[model samples]
Each structure stands twice: as structure tokens, then as C-alpha cells.
Target chain A: MRGLFAARPLLLWPAGCALLVASVAVAITIGPAGISVGEVAAVTVSRLGGADSGLSAIREGIVWDLRLPRTLLAAVCGAGLALCGVVMQSLLRNPLADPFVLGVSSGASTGAVLVVVLGVGGGALSLSTGAFLGAACSFALVLGLGHLSGGTTDRVVLSGVATMQLFSALTSLVVMSSADPEQTRGVLFWLLGSLSGASWPDVWPCLLVLLLALPACLGRAPALDALVFGQDAAGSLGIHVARTRLALLGVTALMTAALVSVVGAIGFVGLVLPHAARAIVGPGHRRLLPVSALAGAIFLVWADTVARTVLDPQELPVGVVTSLIGVPAFVHILYRGRRTA
Target chain B: MSLRAEDVSWSVGGRMIVAGVSLEPAPGQTVGLLGPNGSGKSTLLRLLAGVRRTSSGVVRLDGAPLEEIGRKGAARRIAVVEQEATPQVDLTVGDVVRLGRIPHRRAWAPLSSADEAAVEAALGHTGLTDQAEQSWHTLSGGERQRAHIARALAQEPRELLLDEPTNHLDVRHQLELLDLITRLPVTTVIALHDLNLASMFCDHLVVLREGRVVAAGPPERVVTPRLVSEVYGVRAVVSPDGPGGRPYVRFLPPTGEAR
Candidate 1:
């Protein structure tokens, strides 16, 4: 199956894309109220500017107001996270490197946790704002440390790992000390990552960020290809290695932060999605980035749907389900890598 | 283009690596830099390629200081092929060569017809036309080196800088690559450990010992037995080869006596 996909990237991308659309449709239909697929389709069509006769108000609310936003948010966040993962893997030249692995997600989680647990601000300044601030600050610190250490590739990755560990410990402290039961549960769910409270308001910002950053990242594909050969070679090819690294790192952090702020920290989606994409499309970023984005969207839409309806009334955390699925997939990839070697 | 490095000195990690090295290569001339391991041959090449900032002195291309030209501008003038390059991702051969045209390309622009022509010509020149679509990891050592050369050739720079471009190649590919490099209409500076190959291919020779130039002239004038004995710590017989009077050195076997 892997070889078949690898041999036919053009064929596989559209297949993944079609599956993603189908998964989104299923996601919008499967929830607590259990609307029919026909009702879901009618509500979606009416919302998107068609006739509205077949859909009931309750079905519309379930499909359009709640599940639609949540499912779309899941797709956007997944795509962004996966795209960020592909770029990060190429930029760092380490297959193990991901946005979360570099500690960006942990940093955002710490910020969101502090906001929820401590009620840092009474109004307007909410957990999203806190998460964004945390993510931005940690990313800045990593870049600053990278520069201070002579701007070498090794230095940047080392700094990212160090900052990640520091923020993760801080996040744990915040979670352990929270007094309010609801606040603690909220904080914990945010850390583990869930799309439970996703709304239209939350979805727009992530969509906006993804749309803005995708073109810029795609423009960098060739330079990113040059970078895989090593920094010296990239420089010899006229790439400003330090400047490009800083720019790419900043863009990836912003996208990761935007996604995390909306949907919480979804682990392994960013880490493993790119590898799967590369396994299919090879390592060319132009192909890898887009395909990974689509695959991740499909993967997360289904994962989110499962999280919501697995127990009917009580939704499991999306992060737990992703972890459950991601670990085995990750192990499979490692095994394949070993066999190839 | 002509390249001139004057009083070039460099230090890395507080240890001086290149000291007072002055050299010049005329347009379309191939100059060979010869030294033992760690004698600053690679550092000097890096300095010329603008990959490193020299501690003191100037490296000028044509007449302008290399530092004055930005990376893209400098890359248009000089292309470098380093000794060893290990790519983390398995890029196809064509993708690797396409990178050489980056200095001429805008951030978002696709490859132009001219760029494609250059890449195609480079592949043809390096005899890698058949391997253009192959993954880099699947190539043999010689093929990889040829691919590296093809990348540099695709740059179409006025000057080419190479650090041990023939390090891992078998005899056949080594001769083919050196011959191809020699025929290019560009100034070339190649650091070579093999004196015999350097004598055969390079127009001028610059021999270094302990980061200082010990001799600089035509290969025949500079590659003498005394110089080889003093710099390389080996006794050698210098003989003429080919019609151009290239000097070939034959080293005497060690006598088991400590120097």
C-alpha cells in the first residue's frame, strides 16, 4: 500500500482529499443528537446557499452551529499542525522534530493553563490570549538562544529542546495547583488537547492564520530543499541560512500557536502526519506540505468524531484518542524506517 | 573572473588556521591548493567562497571585496563544491542540481527555460543524465560526487571553488570530473591532497605548510623534490608527464627510521 502511494503521489493526494471531505461530512452528522446524514447534508447545503425545507431547527443547530464549526475547526487545526510539522522536519533536518517536540505546544499549554487555573484576567483576556502569549514567548526565547549560540543548526534544535522541557515543567506545576474543580478539568483537557468547545468564533482565527501562512511556507519549498543538504551547502547556494531559519521558525510558531489556541494541544498529529505524507509523496516539500495538510485534516476529523460519539454522552479528550492512535502509527513508522535501513 | 586573496588570516575557536596567505587566480585559470590534512586548505577555500568571515585581510573577486557583495551576489560569481555533503532528506539528482540556480531565481518564481537548460547541460556534462531522476541515497560514491559537480556547474558562476572534489571517487570518475572541471570557461580553485593529480590538472600551484604558502608558481616550478621533502615530510622524485611538462611525484618508501 505504501509503495503504491509512493509511486503515485498525484493519485494518492486526491484520494486522501476525497476521503477528507467524506470524513468531514460524517463528522458533522455524528454527535449526541445523532442527526441523519441526509439531514446533515441538507443543513450544510442550506447553510452554503441552497434550499432549507428538509432540515429541522434542532438538526440545523446540531449540524451547523455546533458540529459544523467543531469539525471544520478540527480540519483546519489538523492541516495547519501537519503543515507546520512538515516544514519543521525539513527545517531542522531531523525527522523527530515537530512543532510540539520543539516545545511550542507545551509553551502554549502552559499559557492556557495559567489563564484557566488562575483566572489571570476577569474578562476579554481569556485562555486563547494566554496560550498565544506563551507560544510566542517560548518561540522567541528559542530563537534568541539559537542566535546567541552562533546560529548553528545544532544550537537552534538544542535550544528548542531545552525551552520545551522548561515550559512543560511549568505547565505541570500550574495544573497541579489549580483549586477550582471546573478550572482544573478545563486546564487538564486543554493540556491533553480537545475541540469540545470549538465555535465559529474560534475557527475563524485559525482559518485566517492558515490561509495567510500557507503561501509563504510554500514559497520557501525550494530553499527548504536546499537546506536539507546542510547549512554550508545552502549558504553556498545563496540562501541566507540564519535569516531563513528565523523567518521559517517564526511563521511555524505562529501557525502552531493559532491552532493550539483554538483546539488545544494535539500531539503526534504534527509529529507523525508529515512522516506519513513523506512516505507517500517523498520528501519534496511542495508535495509533502499540502498532502500532509489534507491527510491530517482527514485523520483529525475522524479522530474528533470518534472522541465525541465513542461514549455517546461524554466525549473523550481528542488528545487521548490521538495519542492512542498516534503511538501505534508512530511505532509502525519506526519499524519501517528500521527495515528500510 | 579573477580572484585575489591578500594577506588572508583566519582563526577558529581562538586557534589560527590560515595565516598571511596571499594568492591570485587569473580568469579561466585553474589553481590547485595543496597541503596535508588540517593545513587550512579547506579554510582558505571557504574564505574565498565567502562561507566564513576571515579574521584579517581581504578576499576580492574581480576588484570588489567579497564581503561587500551580499550572499546572492557573491554566489552569482563563485560556486563551491565542498569535500563532504550529506543531505538529510533523499532528494532526487535533478532537485539537487536545481538548487545551484537559486541565486538567479526569485523566491517564488519557477525555473526559467535558461535555468532548465543549465541544469540539463550540467547533468549531460557530468554524465548523470541517466541518473537525474534517481534518489541521491541510491547513487554510488562517484556518482554522488559527479552530482555535486553538476550542481556547481549548473550555477554557471564566474569562479568555482572546490574542496577535495575527488575525495571518494574511483580512478575513472576522478579523471573524468577533473577533466570536465579543467575544460570549463571559469576560474577554478581546487584544494587537492594528491600532488600528481593537481600537477596534471591545475594551471598554477599553491603549496601550503602550517597555514603559510611555501611555494607559488607553475606546477613544474613549485612541485620540486626539496619542497615535497620539507612540506610533506617525504622524499620524492619529480618527473615530467604529458606534453605540458606537468610534474609527477613518486614518493620513496619509508626506511623505518624515525624522522
Candidate 2:
């Protein structure tokens, strides 16, 4: 399959797009409400721009309001996170680099906590607004600290670790000192990442951000390919290394911030999906970026479906489900890498 | 003169790595830089390649300052091949060679026929046409060096700079690689450790010590017993029987303990 796609790489894009659409449709049907793919399709078509189907209000509500938005949000979040992962890993030249691992998500969590627990915005700011600000601040701090410490790629990753720990501590301090038991539970579920409250309002903005970012990233594919051999090599190949790094890093941070603000920090989708996509389509970012996004969208749609329906009446954080799958896949990647090394 | 460096110097912190060095290699001439570990050969090559900025003085191509030429413009005219290029990501040999076309590509434009032709010619020149689809990790050290040269060749550069490209290869591979480098049409500046190989291949030679140029001339005048003893702290017998009357150096065994 890898060889076939590697030969005719353009075919993979259409296949990936179809798979994503199919995954979203299938995921919308597998909840507590006994909806089928037909019902999901009918509701989406009618609500989007077709004639109204003669279905009951409650059933249509379940298909349209309850499941469809949540499923679409999962797809967008997955695609966005995976795209960020591919860029970060290639830029940093480390297989382990991801937004969640770099503490961008933790930074977002801290910002959301401050707004919710202390009313930092004095009841005027929404949770996503607080989270975006927090995400930007933490990323800036990471970049500043990394710059101060020689600004090497390894140093940037180390700075990310330091920033992550600091923000996570601040988030814990705010939650423990101020929140009551009920609010604490809500915050905990969010930190672990949940799409349970996903709605249409959350889906479009994240989708729009992804739409804008994918093209911007694709335009820089040759630059990313130059970076595979490290910054010096990239510079020798005519890339303005610092400028390219700053531009790509800024894009990934912005997209990751927007997605985390909407759905909390979903782990492993960013970390693990890029590697899988690379294996299938090879590492040329022209091909890898879109394939990774599609694979991530499909993977998360299914992962969220299992998270919400596995125990019936009790939902697991989607992060937990992804981690359950991600850890083993991560180990397999390592094991395979060892053989190659 | 093709690629020229006029009194270029580089320093890190308070320490100078390359100081007050000037060089001008004529077009199509192969120049060898001979020096010990801390002799600044690599730094000088980097400065010439425009990968590193000189702390003082200037480096120029065709009498124009490299800074004014911009990175992409310079890359189109000059190519640098370091000792090794080890990427953590998986890349095929063809992918690695194709990286040479980066300077000529626009962001949204597809790869053109010119790009494909350059890549194929480079692979053919280096005898790597069959290995284009092979994984980079599967290549031997000599093959890797050839691939690096192939990558440089694909750049279609007028000047090529290399830093100790034969460091890890065996004797035969080392000779073959140097032979290949000298045969190229581009003006070449290569850093070398082995004096005999330097004497054999270089049209001119420059010897550096402690960030300063100690000797600069043809190999017959540059590679001498007294200079080798002074610079490398070794006793050597110099004979003029090597290829093309270039001085051949054979190190004599130590006569006493601790000099």
C-alpha cells in the first residue's frame, strides 16, 4: 500500500478525503440514540441546504444537534492537531515534538483555569478567549526562554518542557485553591480533554482555522524538506532559517491554540498520527501534511465515538482513549526505530 | 578569481576561530586547505560557502559581496558539502539529491523538467542512479559521501566547497572521492588531512595554523619537511618524486622520547 501510494501520490488525497467524510458519517450514528447513516445524512443535508425531512423533532434534534456537531468537531480537532504535529516534528527534527508535549495545551489549560476560577476577565471573557490568550502567552514564553538559551532546536524543546511544567503547576494551584468539588470535576474532565459539549459554534471556527492553515503550510513544503537536514543545511539550501522557523512555528501555535480553546487538549492525536501518515505516504510534506490531517480526522472521529459509547451513561475523556491507543503505537514506533538505528 | 575571501575572520565569544585569511581560487582550479584539527580550515570553508558570516572583512563571488547576493542567489552559484548529512527523518537517496533543486524552486510551482534533468545528471555523475530509491541509512560511508557530492553537483554550482569530506572513508574510497572531486568542472576548495592526497590532487595549496595562514603556494613549495615539522610537530622526509613533481611527504619515526 505504501509503495502503491508512493508511486501515484496524488490518489492518496482523494482517498483520504473520502475516508474522512465516511468516518464522520459513521461516527455520528453510533451513540445512545439509535440513528443510522441515512438519518445522519438526511439531517445534515436538510439543515445545510435541502428540503426538510418529515422526521420527528426529537429524533432530528438527536441526529443534528446532539451527534453531528460533536462528530464534526472531533474531525476538525484531530486534523488540526495532527497538522501541527507534522510541522513541529519536521521543524524541530525530533520525532517526539507535538503541541501537547511542548506544553501549548497545558498553557491553554492554565489560561482557561484563570478565567474560570478567578474570573480574570471579570465575567466578560469566554473560555476560548482566555485559553487563546493563555496559549499565546505560554508559546511566547517558550520562544523567549529558548532564545535566551542559545535558540537551538534542542534548547527550544527543553524550554518547552520548562514552560509546560510551570504552566501545569499554575493551573493546578488555581484549581485546587479556588474551585469547589463540582467545578473541580468539570475542570479535571476538560484538562483530560472531552468533546462531550461540542456544538456547531465550536466546529466551524476550528474548521476555518484548519482551512486557512493547510494552504499556508503547503506553500512552505520545500522549506520543510530543506529542514530535514537541520538548520545549517536548510540555510545552505537558500532558506532563511530563522524567518522560516518563526513563520511556521507561529502558524502551528495559532492553529493549536484555536483548537485547544474549543476542545481542551487532546493528547496523542498530534504525537502519533504524523508518524503513521509518514509511513504510508513518505515524508514529503506536500503529501505528508494533508494525509496526516485526513488520517487524524478519521482516527479521532472513531476514537471519540468509542470514548463516548464504550461504557454507556459514563463517558471517558477522549484524551484517555487516544492515549490508550497512542502509547502502544508509540512503543511500536520506538521498537521499529531501534531496529533501523 | 572565482570565489574570493579577503582577510575574513570569525570569532565565537572572545575566541577567534579563523583570523585574517585571504584566498582566491582561479576558475576551474582545485585548491586544497591543509591544517590540523584547530587550524580553522572548516571555518574558512564555511565562510567561503556563505553558511557562516565573517566577523571581519568580506567574502565575495565574482567580486560582489555574498551578503548582497542573498542566500538563494549565492546558493545558485555556490554549493557546500559538509563532512556528513545525517537527517533523523527517513529519506530516500533520490530525495536527498533532489534537495539540491531547492534554491531554484518557487513556493507553489511544481518541479520542472530542468529540476529532473539536474537530479538525473548528478546521480549519473556519481554512479548512484541505481541507488536513487534506496534508503539513506542503507548506504555505506563512501556511498554517502558520493551522494553528498551528487547533491552538490545537482545544484549546478560554479564553485564547490567541501570540509574534510573523506574523513571517515577507507584509503581506496578516499583516493576515489578526491579523484572525482578534482575532475569536476567547478572551482573546488577542499579541506584535507592527508598531505600526500593534497599534494597529488590540488592545483594550489594553503596551509593554516592557529587560525593564520602559514604558507600559500603550489604544492611543490607548500608541502615541505621543515614546514610540516614546524606546523604538525612531526619529522618528515620530502621527495619530489610524486605525481607531476609535487612534493611527497613521508613521516620519519620518532628518534627520541619527548622531543
Candidate 3:
């Protein structure tokens, strides 16, 4: 776990960012019609200068319209999910607590689908707003269930799983009963997580959330360090246990709701990236949160690139690649926990 | 600064865990709280630390009510080490100790040189400097105890409260921990089960029985054979004193046959 530049963690922020930039530059070039990494970079730089890089307008359009926005969205989603993973793990004092695994995202999916199908607010509320409400509902349900069942880590996780199943069933019923074939297709694509139609419109809100949530999380890092020890220790250290828990819960839920609404229920980035970043930067959130965010951005940029390029003309859902990676990662964590215990 | 509890009480589920108990330790005194199992030692310590709100009565820090100062303000002056301080995370010894600086640091401010020096001094005081980078989960019970003390020490607090800190420690570590607490120029309130350790190190002793103060005074006077036998259900004779010049309790054979 201490292998990834744990000693010089300050170096990780800039290095990780540079790695993301390079990965984006390289990943944008890979697609059905072969374009080189160098050509991708040139086209991107030329567009920045407001000059057409002597390539065909079709290639330029592909670079600007299709690939760039999708890649950036992937980065944002990855960072947001991972950052929230750091928060949920610390807040719940359980590493197994991720939005997707705990079924918190299923709540958001239900909200978005409610809007997509039944039109819950009669055009007054957006899908994103509904999704946020659903996330909060799921969070409340999980906490209530956990309290009812003694609220151990195992119980909390089980409650999350239960909440997830219930919401998913309700979401499917809403979709199946109401949506037309075309809207159903889009909803299905969303459920599975496809970044097919990414644009600048999708970029700003995510950027705004990241800008707001990342610093907010950073401010709570020290309090989080005490929390992983236990509530008593945190309280002794002068943390108002109930208030701190409430604040962190609100922050993590908000960020996760926003990200899930934008990009369906993208799993694994939340679970995988935080652990990876912990190994690289050690367990303090001051370093871990930023490193996790960067690692997530780097991870998804490549995952999304692979999702698009793995099958030349046909595209795969980004969630498919992440799940393929996440299942093994989760098993490894359980194994590690057993060995340590 | 002094810590004074004025008729403090706490209850849970309508059961009185800590009944009316008032205690006042002098400035920079090492006061040991001794009690039998289920005698409210831990509860009293929590009340003193302001982590547990008292059902009735006030715990004052240097004359100001502890709760009135607020958690952040109280934490700035008081550091409490609970009995179970083992962390359930992949953290190093350094990471745990650094948390003591939380009440002191601004949320946005990074760890300063002063914070580093405090942590360094604490690790050294607890003889944990070499293990600062060691994984927390890998520590032995005694080492973990020391790490907890080191963490509390890192807070640079004026009032220190420890709940049964020596339970997991070996004899040497137990002595070392109490020795460090007595020598540190702070108002220390420690809850201990070992009467001998309490007698040898603490400036004063407060003994609790069923959530009430049964005895309170210097160790030599308060630690009587009758007191030990009555409070702990043990038949013991009070020897003259240990090498530390404090009364030692030597148990005689039980008056009743072993059932």
C-alpha cells in the first residue's frame, strides 16, 4: 500500500495532473478511424489557437465535438466518485462503503428515471434535482436500517444493498410501465453508463461540483483522520461527533448524487481509486483525497478510452470496464483485511 | 489550569451510570481514579472531558464551565485517551499522533513546524520515535497503549484524562506510562484498576464504588485493608509501603472457600 510515492506525496499532485493530461492527449487519438496521439495533440493545440490544423474538418470535428468532451466528462466523473469514496469510507468508518456497492446510486437512478418516465414534478424539477432527492432518501433509508440493526459496518453495508435492490426494482417498474421505446433506450444506456453524448453543457456543472466539493473535503481531512480511529477518539480530540458525521454525510451524499446524475451509476471508480491513492500517498486525507481524485481522473480517462476503442466501431459502456476491474479489487481488500486481522 | 467537577451525574437508558460525584484536583496534580468494574470510572472521565454531557452538574476547566467553552475550546486545553484507542485503518503511528493537532490548527492551514515539534516531542516522550512510521495495526498491545499516550501528549494539553490506559500494558510499560503522567506538568485524571500503580504514582486518589465516591484522599490514608476488601470483594492486608513509599495491598487468603 505504501508503494506509490508515499514518501513524496506533495510531488504526486503535479505529477498525477501531468499524467492525466498526457493520458488525455494520448487517449483522445484512439478511436474507430485511426488517428495518432501526436495528431490529436496537434489538433487540440491548433484549436486552442483558433486555427484549423490542416486535417480534414471531419477529424477536427471528431476531436472537438465527440472525444474531448467525453474524455473530460470521464475525468470529472472519475474524480468526483473517488473523492466521495474517500469521504464515505472515512465517515462510515468502513472501507466497503461505496455509493454503487451500497446501492446509494440506485436511489439517484430511481430519481432520474422518475423524471425520465413519470415526470414527477410536471416539468418543475429537473432530473438532476430528482436524483439528488433520491440519493438523500437512500441515505436516510440506509442510516435508519443500520440503526435498526445495530449499525455495524456489515449491517450498514447490508442495509445499503437492500436499499439498492428495492430502488432498482422500483426504477425498472417505472421505466417499463411508462417510457416509449426511444426514451427507454436512452434510460438503458444511462443505467449502464454510456458517455456517448458528452458536450460542454455536461462539463460545467461537474466542474463546479468538483471545485466546490474537493476543497470542502480537504478542510475535513483532519477530522476524518480521528474518525477512522472511532467516534470516542474523535470526540476526545474535540470533534463534535454528531455534527461532524452529519456534515460529512451531507457533503459526500451531495457530491455522489451530482456525479451519479451526470453519468449514471458509474461503479468501481469510487471503490478502486481511493485505495490505489492510499497506497501511493498513505492514509491521511490531506494527501489521500487529492491523490485519489487525480488517480481517478487518470484511471477513467484510460478506461473510457478503452471502452470506446476495445471494439472498433461498436462502443462499450465505461461501467463495464470499471466493474471488470472493481470486482477483483474488492476481493483483494477482503483478503487483505483477513490477513491483517 | 485545574479541572473541577461539581456534583456531576450521567445516565443512560434511565439507568444512572454516574451518580452525584464532585471532585477537585489541585493545579498540575496527577489524580488517579480507582474503581471496581461497572463503577462509573470511564463515565466520569468522559464527563470530565466534556465528551459526555452531564445529566446534572457542571465540569469546569479553570473555573469556566467545560461545556460552555465549547468542544473546540475545551479540546484546546484538555486531551482524553479512551481505553480502546486502536485504530481500524491503514495508518502509521505518525498519522495517529498528527491528529492531536486538529483542535489547534485552522481547517485550511497545513501542519506547521510547531505541530511537527509537538508530535516529535510526544513520540520521544513515549519512546515511540523509532516506531513513528510503523503500521498501527502491527503494534503490540503495549506499543498501542504507548501510541495512544503519545497521541494524547501530542495535543500539548493542560488537562489530560486517561481511562484505564495501563490495562493492556506490560508491567514495565504500565510503570513507564504512569511515571510519564506523574512527571508531566499537567492536571492528569487517570482511571486505573491497579491500586498499586495508582498508589505509587498519583498525587491523590479518588475511589469509586457503584457510581459514588467511597473514599478520596492520599493513597496511604485512603487505601486501607478494609477499603480494598469491601470495595473489591477481596481480603487483603495493607503492607507498610512499596519502594515508591506508597501503601501496597497484599491479598490474604479469601475468608470464604473458593466456590
Candidate 4:
């Protein structure tokens, strides 16, 4: 998608859609199972009330129940994380800002640990609910601290860093003190992020959240453009600076919380994808947001495919896979930027 | 009158930055605000531009109170260029200029024909047609200021406010920028440091000292050596040999002490 039809911006969107579809289709075919694209399409059509797919129960279950949900979740999380990253980076005017930079992921981990190891929710609350609650609390804390520190962009980032450190420490202390070795391993696996537990229930809520958040962010693209100049300049340009900042920051936080609760904090997708997308589409938020979302979707689909299948019997963490690929790609982007500059 | 500030005062942390200042610039008049460092020139301009609310008194735009107008409505009428507003993102010159059309555009709509035409006219007016596709990071300081002015011009504003717009420019670029500003039909209120340049370009001059208007009139009457000594604590000679009989100020060295 980087060089293909890039000269003609009109064809970029259609090409992006096709690339994303192709990525999902191809990614679904890569697992331990020997399901082909036709079988996968037949199982999907059969689920949608088409004719029966000529496949046994085991193969159908693997396609319908297992691989489809995981792959779709990967795409959804990828798009959502990248969207949140674009919003955060633009709103805060900080290039280093990411979805989890504001401590949402750390808070989610703490919440999951509390529910899983300490049994704080008394068996009624699921892990995702606990994580969501924790993420919200962390975001609220960051906002409060930022407000106390004069509500400037740098102050917000400083507060986010402080909140992240606090929540991370709390999560570590709780897991270390109370959990057994088995519980510790389980918490660690979720902390490092994996898509192995992706189910249909986890997929839809995230997709719904992404669907709601994408349009909402798109509507504020012009406001984000105004914000590239400082707050006074934006105010002079008719942007309600405080209101636009709050709305965008809130959308990013909610989307980040939803995705983190579902996928256990997939790293690098939020931080790196926006830069890659910006390189493709330039800094205009209208093109940058959608391009980032698509690029992220394609990227994570492939990353998750490699994560689950690289070691064959043992699954490496998706976060590990992302960093392994993200670092070299990040270096390449920096090198190119240097040459261009 | 296009823009009027009557007894406007702004204070921060119990310190008055602009105290009881009144300014009224007629339509298409270029008013220069002259002051030493921290004499509230920037604050006065901000208040007049509706970028900051006055602590006391009123600012009226076209006989309507500025606070009554909505942000978008005010922005459509007034565009401000501050001293420091460099964007962090790597944007093209065209992208920076297109930001001026935000007020005229709706949230979900694409650029209208009017917006494009205005942008093109602004780029043409600033002589930046060839540099529109250039990266903003590669632009020189003067070109950056011209781009900023072009962005403001794209708003099609009736009133323009600038704070030390030529602070970082060379002499030729400074004259070119101020020349461009004075030729615009919009009523402009600019804060400037150079007395001779201010006198040469500004139709009227308002000198500020300690947040108060020390002198206000045509540049020839206001740019005297006595006013310079009183307001800026410096000795200067004002001669009427400048362009168009505007006063030219030449500073004289102190005879006794460095203080």
C-alpha cells in the first residue's frame, strides 16, 4: 500500500480496502489447520445462511469458531489502536504519544490481575470488565493530574507517565505478593499480549467500539489540523481549543480502553503505525486517520499470523512479534526521514 | 470603525499587563503599536483580536460586543498572526495555508470552490505560488512569516492582528512583509519594535509605557525624541526626512554613564 497508487490519491482508498480484505483473507489461511480460502469462504457463507460447506465438523469449527474470530479481532484491534494513536499524537502535539502512553494499558493489566489473582470481583466480573474499569480509572487519574498541573500538553504527558509508573508498580506488587506460580504465569502471558483467547464475544464489542470511534474522530479532522499550531493560534482560527482537546482525548481514551480490555495491550501498533501512515498520506488528518487505520489493520493481521505460527507448537507473544518487526521498520523510516530532510 | 477596544485591561496573577487602553482603528487603516520589551504590546493586540478576554472594559467589532459573537463568527472576521506559532508536524506550505479555511468549512465537508480560490489568491498575493508545494520545515524565516500571513489572508478577514511579525526577518524581507500588510484592505493593528519602520509603514502610531498608552496620533507627531526618552528611557533624534515625511529616529549615545 505504500507505493501502490500513491501518486494518485483517489485510488489509494479503494486500494487500501482491497489490501485489507486480501490481508484478512490471506491471514485466515495461515494456521496449523489446512483450511484453504475456498473452505474459509464456504464456512463464512454457510454461517451467513448460504449452502452447506463440504467440510467436517472439526475443520468447520476451526474455521468458524477459532481462526475467524482471532483474525477479525486482530484487524479490529489494529485499526482501533492506530486510530487512537493518531488522535493522541495530534491532540497532545507529542510525537511520542501512543494509546497506552496515558497508562490505560497498565491500568487494564492491574484490573485483570485484581480480578484474576486476588478475586477482587468475587467471581462475578469477567477479566475484560475488570480491565475496562481499570483503564477508565487510569485515564481519569491522568486527566485529573493533568488538570492539576495546568492542563498543558507537556503536563498531560508528565501526568500520564506518572500514572503509568504507579499502576505498573501496583500490578507488579499485587501479582508478586498474592499469586501462585501458575497464576503468575497466566498473568504474565496476558500482560505480554496474545490473541489466542480471541472469541466471537471479544470481537464484536471491539469492532463496534472501533466503528463508533472512527467516524467521531474523522469528524474532528479539521479541528486536529488547527491544533497543529498552538492553542492560541487554534483559538484564533475558530477552534474551541479546550473543547476539541477534551473530545478527541476522550475518544482516544475510550477506544484505547476498549481495545486493551479485549486484546491485553498489543504494543507497537498504536505507536508506530501512525508514523508509517503519516509518511504515506502526509500530515492531513482526513487522509492520515483512515490510512493509519488500514495500515495498522494489515500490519497486525500479518503480525498475529507470524506470532501464532512462527514457533509451530509454542506461540510467541504478539507484542514480541510486533517489536521485533517494528524496530527495524522504525529505523528505516527514521533513516528515510533523515535523507529527505 | 472596524475594531475598537475601550478601556480594555487584562491582568494575570494580580498584575495588570494592559491597563485602561482604548484603541479604535478605522477601516483599512494600519495602526502600529510601539513599545519597549514587556510593555504589553502583545497583550493589547491579543485583546483587540478577541484571542483573550479583557479583564475590564469592552472590545467591539462592527459595533457588536466581541464576547457576544461566537468563536467561528469572530474568526471569520478577524485573523491573528502571533510571534511564535510554528507547528510540530511536518506540513507543506499549502497545507499550512489551507488551515486558514477551517472556519469557512464545515466539520465533515471537503474544501469548497470558494476555499480553494481564496487559498490560491492568498498564495498568489504572498508570492508563494511556486513554494506552495514546498515543505514548511525547509522555508526560511521570512518565507515562514509570509506563509503565515497568507494563511491569515485566506481567512478573508476584515481585521488583522500581528505580534512582532518581522522579528526574525532580514531588512529586505521585513520591508516586503510590512509593505504587503499596509497594502491589504483589512484594518490592521501590528505590534512593532523598530521605530523607523513603524513610522514609515504605520498610518497611525500608539506608544505604550507600563501598560498605558503614552502617546497616540499620526506617526510624525507621536515619534518625537521626548516621547522616546519618556517611554523607552533612551535619547533619540526624530527627523522628518523619512519616506513620505514620516519621522526617522536616530538613537544618541548616553554621555555620562552606562546606566
Taken over the whole model, the C-alpha lDDT of each candidate is 0.85, 0.90, 0.84, 0.91
Per-residue lDDT of model 4, residues A80-100, tens digit only: 999998998988899889999
lDDT of 1 by residue, B33-79 (tens): 99889899999998898888789999988789988987888888899
Candidate DockQ scores, in order:
0.58, 0.75, 0.64, 0.76
For residues A4-60, what per-residue lDDT tens digits would candidate 2 score against the true structure? Answer: 998897787788888889888888888787888888878878988897867799999
What digit string (tens of lDDT, one per residue) describes model 1 on residues A14-75?
68878988888877877657677677778878888988747668667878889989999999
Q: Which stretches of candidate 2 lie above 4 Å from their native place?
A: A332-338, B253-259
Which residue ranges in model 3 land beyond 4 Å of their true spot?
Answer: A1-4, A36-49, A52-57, A101-103, A113-130, A143-159, A172-189, A327-341, B252-259
Best by lDDT: 4
* Model 3 agreement with the true structure over A1-341: per-residue lDDT tens digits: 57547776667768888898998888887777677887787788898895657889898888888888889999998898899888888877777677565566899889888987888899987877887788878988987898799756567678888999999999889888899998888777777776777887887888888899888888888788878778877888888877776677667777777777777887788877787677667888888888889888888888888888888678888899888876787677667656455
Highest DockQ: give the candidate number.
4
What is the TM-score of candidate 2? 0.96
Candidate 4 regions with alpha-carbon error over 4 angstroms: A1-7, A339-341, B255-259
> How big is the positional error of residue B232 in model 1, measured in Å on the Cα after superposition?
3.6
Cα error, candidate 3, residue B91 (Å): 2.0
The model with the greater lDDT, 3 or 4, is: 4
- Supply the DockQ value of model 3: 0.64
TM-score of chain A of each: 0.94, 0.96, 0.87, 0.97
Q: What ranking emerges by TM-score with the best candidate at the front? A: 4, 2, 3, 1
The parts of candidate 1 lying over 4 Å away from their true place are A1-19, A36-38, A48-54, A121-124, A177-185, A331-340, B6-9, B12-15, B54-58, B64-69, B171-173, B233-245, B252-259
The residue pairs that clash in candidate 4, if any, are: none
Task: Determine the TM-score of chain B of model 2.
Answer: 0.97
Q: Per-residue error at B240 for model 2, in Å?
A: 1.9
TM-score of 3: 0.90
